[model samples]
Target: MRALTVKQPWADAIAHGEKRIENRTRPIPPKHLGTTILIHAGATEDFNALPADMVRAWPKDVRAVVALATLAGCHKAAKPRCCAPWGFPDTWHWELKDIRPIPHPPRPVRGQLGLWTVDDDTLAAVQRQISIERTSA
Candidate 1:
């Protein structure tokens, strides 16, 4: 299983299905996609100006929560334009469907991107139930 580390609120939004875009680079090529991916809810640099669509769908009780979500699909945000740049677009959008709050993740790192492989035990730790108490702190 390949786990992806994502920033804060976006991770939370993904967990609740409010946000579809991971808002960063693709962890790996579309082919490298393995059996499952873990959603690492770490901190993000910017305060999302949050789009209108996001605000409408965002869980009302949500507060800077981080969650682990399984990947469903990865697609381009829009048609790739010709005049952009040398490399792929700065943003590689991902769809987060099966999302759950990861209570405690090991080596919880903070960054915009990184895809690493994890074993069964780590997977179990991620799948463990989270006590969703209180609103965002």
Candidate 2:
């Protein structure tokens, strides 16, 4: 599965369903639309940079694969809407759908910029985690 590395608090927010749109400087490629992607929380903690309310609602897990979401579409907006609070003007908003948190504990992995491929072993682990989440849900 493909994965996108997102920064700490925002990643956690996406995994927990508090945020549904991911803000980016560039638009996602057309091929990524309607595809499921892993949300990898990057290894950077900036709690002081986040809003106090968000800091208060931080997820227990970080710096790992926290969830899976469908990349529904991507759009550039002059004024932010779905992800306005977390987005800057003139950025692309990647709409997300069918967000699901991984039931198992977060698996640590190094993250890279833009969309990247997950290795076979990590993919298998993530698949297993998703399977468990499905059965339990």
Candidate 3:
């Protein structure tokens, strides 16, 4: 599937489920299109953009975006995504049913909170959806 290449912490957050808003200069594509694979793109560029305050809070923690997802029909945010859930509780707050890790696990997921993908099969499904939506519009 098309990848969103999130940084370390943010990618970890999504994989683990701890962060809510995957803050970005460019917002995730609006929900107007068909379902796109929530790729936990591994760290690409170092998160030098992390605010000083955030760094102070999370000294070792890294930040990446694309972990946050809208529960398909529901707009409520699911639980934060990260191996370390920080100090927060891990609960399915939203209705996100299908979550697939496009690439192989950078690390163990601990538990399969959502669907996981490591190849083109699942990615194709999301890709098809994206293509359909793009053409529809």
lDDT of each: 0.50, 0.76, 0.37
Report the lDDT tens digits of candidate 2 across residue range 12-120: 7788646887888889888777788889988886767667776575574666888888888888866534456655667788888888887664567888889888777
lDDT of 1: 0.50
Tens-place lDDT per residue, model 1, 56-119, is 6544322222465555566564655421331235566665555665555544343344666655
Error of 3 at 66 (Å): 10
Worst 10 residues of 1 by lDDT: 81-90
lDDT of 3 at 32: 22
Cα displacement (angstroms), candidate 2, residue 22, comes to 1.2
Per-residue lDDT tens digits for candidate 3, residues 1-137, read 23344465555445544454333333234542234435354434344544455444432322222332333322323355432333223322222323433223323222122333334553354454432232211
Which 10 consecutive positions of candidate 2 have the poorest summed lDDT?
128-137
What is candidate 1's TM-score against the reference?
0.53
lDDT: the better of candidates 2 and 3: 2
Among the numbered candidates, top lDDT falls to 2
Which of the two candidates, 2 or 3, achieves a greater TM-score against the reference?
A: 2
Task: Name the best candidate (by TM-score).
Answer: 2
Q: What is the lDDT of residue 50 in candidate 3?
A: 47
TM-score against native, each model? 0.53, 0.83, 0.35
